[model samples]
Target: MIPRLKAWWRMFDTFTQRCLAVSVVLAIVASACLVQLVNVQLLDGRTTAEAATNSRTSKVTLSAKRGRILDTNGTVLAQSVERYNIIGVPDAATSFTPVTCGSKQAKSLGYCHAIDDKPVGATGAAAVARLLAPLLGMDAMELGAKLNGTNQYVVLKKEVTPQVKREIDKLNLGGIVYGELSSERVYAENTLIGALLGGVDDEGKGASGLESSLDDELAGTDGYTVYQRGNGGEVIPGTVTKTQEATDGKDVSLTIDADVDWYVKKVLSEGVSAQHAQWGVAVVQDVQTGEIIALEDSDSIQAGSDEAKLGSSRAVSQTFEPGSVGKIPALAAIMQSGVKITDQFTIPYEMEKDGQKFHDASSHGAEHWTLAGILQNSSNVGMITAAANVTNQQRYDMLCKFGIGQSTGLNLPGESNGVLTSPESWDTRSKETVLFGQGYTVNALQLTRAVSVIATGGINRQQSLIKSVSTSNGKQTSKLNTSATRVIDENTANEIKNAMESVADRWNKVINVSGYRIAMKTGTAEVAGDSGALTSIVADTVGFLPADNPRFVVTVVMKDPAGVHGGTTAGKVFAQIGEFLMQKYDVPNSAERTDAIPVEW
Candidate 1:
């Protein structure tokens, strides 16, 4: 085979051999080119194309519409409105030119660069500013200065209404001046529910109050759009390659009544001012549903204001000793232990028990008083004597059952679970003070709900502020996952109710609401003042209306008031709010009180 190959090679000339080698080399080069062509066209074509397109693509975030906050009666408390930010490309504005009239007839028609038919006689940034100044309510010279910058992008103005945006659009300053979509939150009742409604941050996220707590429900999923852009960073027409629609936030309806809240805030502010107090809080709740109809604070700041960002709702944040108002639970515990409201006690001005001295708010000689009288007079000494039958653990358990020393379940931001220590942690003095509401602390909402247990016939319903949430799919009622539990028997609740009614009857002059009966308890406690001394007073009143059949519970608290007594200061505010509630709800007149337990033996 080797000899035959050598003979065939000799048959060809040197030139033909060289030509054959060149042809073979050309064919090999062509084959390699073909392979590369196939690889590029079949294997990586899409990747190459995508890379080319991506270089010119732009993605824009689309803001989702934040949900509206509504009151129980469908009143819009807070809402997001369509707004626009006037964006100016300073580089583009420097070359901006307005359309000029080409003919005399065109100039007479006022279509040229003129305002009210007055010739602008300007170009570039000055002309652009003159066209937009009146529409934006800005000074022409100032606007011109903003447009004269060298930056590629500049925000001339933000949160302009849609009407103003349209007016600017009609000026035909297309590339020079454009609008970027945005939203502005507008509060209907400015400062009425300010603290409770909360406000959103600059980026439109909830910062506090209900806005922060329910942010997830209120802030829906934000979508985005991907599109091709021109060299100048402008989105090319019809070049939307990808898009995802924004999901608008769900509308949250609160149990609060806007009108009622406004009224309560007004009354509470006036009351706080009249008493020369530091601040005040008032809360109203529905007996059956446990809905907070109104929550007001004297120092309520406007929503979306700088001050609101720093503070929280005082009703759920501020904690103080409930004083005599804490006695009802002790009374309930004593009565539940088979002690009757008619049970008598020999009360003294002061008494010593377990090396601790206890006294009533006022000095009194030894007198025969029933258990009902002890509560009606708010006698701390009488409370100690009457509570002698109940154990410390029993008192602690009762207070816990009444929702003391715990969050009210409203889930408000900065809410405090007021300090309630265990029974074992209580000292001898604390044990006795706890009976009359001094050893522990509670927020206004906690104290309100505690009183509500009696009004609700011993059922401790979960307190809720958000009534429902409405979304794209449908409306969903907020389920707090907390069930109502019975704290006391119905008979015991009625007995406590009747005793509170007697207390209200005793202070009818200040607490009475005409045409309706009220069952109330007043409290006053000495807390640490600004100087850190026990000189400040927390005066509060908590009760339910139409004592015969309670419908609503109202609580009013005043801090460091001139009228150091709860019955006179906070109680007066309660009466005003109660009267307004009765009239607003059209509640029927209460029947005359037929059941009254005698107080004095």
Candidate 2:
């Protein structure tokens, strides 16, 4: 009886061990299921939703219309034109079988035979290519190969006509697609202001000029659309889920006058060609506001010609020795420092200082001349002698105040600041040479504005090219006012103006207008070669019209002219431009005619 009872206990213990093992396996499997359920419900819920949406939804980018660039009088310089892009998606169509069972032979052959679908197959590609070849001026064989390729997307042409796009849409060809993009740039005046307006790149971004500088303001925001796509990545009908509208850019108005600009360009081109010079620049500015009325350069940048690429505007980019024009600013500085404006000097043919020689344009024995006489004669030696009264630091300060050694604030790309040596860097001869308009450089724009100080009553106004900005709602958003700074006393500026009147009188043989009293100064700068030897000359003339009551400041600069003096080459151009401005703007002649200032005091 005891042995039987022990066997029963052993059997019960073995059964309990087996039951515990099964329970442990079930617990492990239940724990894994709970962990996976938590991950799917909480950890990656958003990611899963996004994946599902991406599988069916497609995003399409929308292009915004670029702004128009206009002149001061609402003349459009650059604008956007409507255009389209021709596209082809080789795999946009699905596989299908074509059948023709209406014929008796097809009915007798038991049933309609399944033929290969011509819309998406090689046969379809060839047929479509042949149909579009004549309409699109494309090679049939090449287009057929493209249509038969494995590429999912391809652009066949850009800047396509709207009519052609409409014709293509009517075909209802499979795997063929086209869309419109309104980012193409069009020049309204065609190369008249190409350099200033700049050109657009292939991607419709501004490449240069004001277009590049104000790209942000000129380029509006682009929007996008989200829609459902079919299996072939084509937009499904009535499945547009979301869309955002595009905005157009603002309109930019420049300070230039189109009519005046055209006239100036004509005169400048003729002047450059007549002189057979390297280049030329002509600028006309309103001294009071510092608004550039008319500006032109020798390089005529054509609209669509890639061969004659527009070079930099030499008016503000190229720098050269200021020559006699430097004397105007020098004279202004000396007079502002209380030097006797009427002080007399004995100017000789040549004078030497620190082993360096300075001379007048012509050989004149020591002759008596006043400060005004020195400017009228453009005497280098006399200028150096007169400038000796002022310190080197004083001279440098005058140049700085006149806007030399810095940009003119024209807001154009690649503007150069004329070179003005620091006072500390001046040597024994540096001051003398610089005083006579040597050892320093200035571009045409800088030089013209510097001289405008005399015309603007001793105030320097910042030069500007932008006039205003307008929005699409036809509201004037902003109008810019050029900054003004007092550089010299009004009395001193008038005194220099009087002296410039005499300078213009001396060159009357070449630059005198019929009924206008013009105040002018001529500069003949010796152009030095790479080896520091004089090779050519730059002739320049800068001044204001109606000397008694100045209105417009006209400046003409010609490089490497056939003639040596500004009075002969640039002065004529200046006179011509002055006459045109007087007539174009209807500027009246001076109320009273004044006696000419003495050339030889």
Candidate 3:
């Protein structure tokens, strides 16, 4: 068998054996190629295709629209408007050519630059400058200089209106000119509530004021889109692979009334100027709801301006000794401790107690006066005498309950909590001074809320400026979860109201409002001046109108005024604002004070 096999192998010639060996090698190579082709085309096909598509695709950020800041009446205070930054490709502009007339694309172009029915003679950057100058309100020479740079991309103009951008697009300079979407924050009321509304940064984020505190609610979620782009850097049509819709921010509605705020500011500025005061602040709040209807400062700050970035609402930031106005809380504590409104005391111009001497604002002989008369005349000596009934701890507790040295719950930026030391920290003179509102300090809003307790039937409610927030779905009222606590009984509040009414009656000539009864108290404290000396005075008045049926509480504070007494300077300003409020709200005339409490024996 082996000999037969060897004989058969010799049957083929050398040339045929060599050709057959080459043919076998070629078949093995073909089989290897087929296996590789199957692996590449089937196993890794989807991944390879995706990688190729991703190379040409780009992701673009879609900015979410910022919400509007609205007043109580639905008036737009602050808003964001769509705008564009005109972009120029300087390198591309060098090859720009003017469009020809009678062309299909030219027919649709509303305004075209042409000479003798021919395209503009200028070419390159000059042509682009000439065509865009009129639309962009720029000088042709300057624009040409900017477009002649070697930079591939340059911002030609920033924050142009959408209408202007459309006109620029009509030029049909696709590669040379384009637009980048942007937004411009506009304040409709300008200086009205400017500092309170605050301003935003270059990235459109809130930088100060209520704008900063409520930034999260005002700045919605930003979306994005992934799409393929051509070599020219333009998005290819129908190539959007993925997109996420932007969620617009919710509109913030404030409890403030624009008209009331304007009037209060006008009155406050005039009063501050009249007295040659350093600065002034005023606040108006609803008695029942604790809504701040008006917050004003003497110096107006324009929103989005340099000044707005430097300061905020002084009504909540500036703190000073409340002076005699501070006496109300101490007196209330004394009254609640079984001291009758008609309780009699022999008051003098000055007196010594606990080794500390105290005096009234005026020098007078010893006279008999009741608790009501003591507050009406604002006698410091009489107050200290009455404060004897309540302990220092009781006095401090009342002041704390009145919101002294505590947060206003407004969440306003830069707000000061004011200074209120505990009874344990009080010295001999501090204890006596605390009785007449001299040792502790409070801001305008805090003082306003302190007085409002009487008007609210002895209940202390949390104050708020924000009314509600509106989204795409609908409007949702702001749930502040404000706490309300009973500071005194209704009877005690009425007694205090009657006493404050007597104080207003004594100042009838200074704070008179026709057909209206106002319960009021004035304050005067000596504070450190700019020179850091205790020479400056803070004169202020706080009260609620229609004293019998309280509605609104108004407070006015003047720093370093010519007239140091709160009753004369701040009192006059209060009258003007009170009169306007009556007419604005159409409030009913106050009933005659038939049950007036006797201020004297």
Q: Candidate 1, which ten residues in sequence have the lowest lDDT sum? A: 103-112
lDDT preference between candidates 1 and 3, better one: 1
Going through the candidates in the order shown, the clash numbers are 0, 0, 0
C-alpha lDDT of all candidate models, in order: 0.88, 0.77, 0.88
lDDT of 3 at 330: 85
Candidate 2 clashes between residue pairs 3 or more apart in a chain or in different chains: none
Residue-by-residue lDDT tens digits, candidate 2, 385-473: 78777888889989889888878776676667867878899888878877767888888788888989999989888887788888899
lDDT of 1 at 57: 83
Predicted structure 3: lDDT:
0.88
- What TM-score would each prediction reach against the true structure? 0.86, 0.84, 0.87
- Model 3 / residue 544 / CA error / Å: 0.6
TM-score computed on alpha carbons, candidate 1: 0.86
Q: Mark the regions of model 3 whose C-alpha exceeds 4 Å error after superposition.
A: 1-56, 100-126, 139-153, 230-235, 480-482
Error of 2 at 378 (Å): 0.6
lDDT rank order: 1, 3, 2
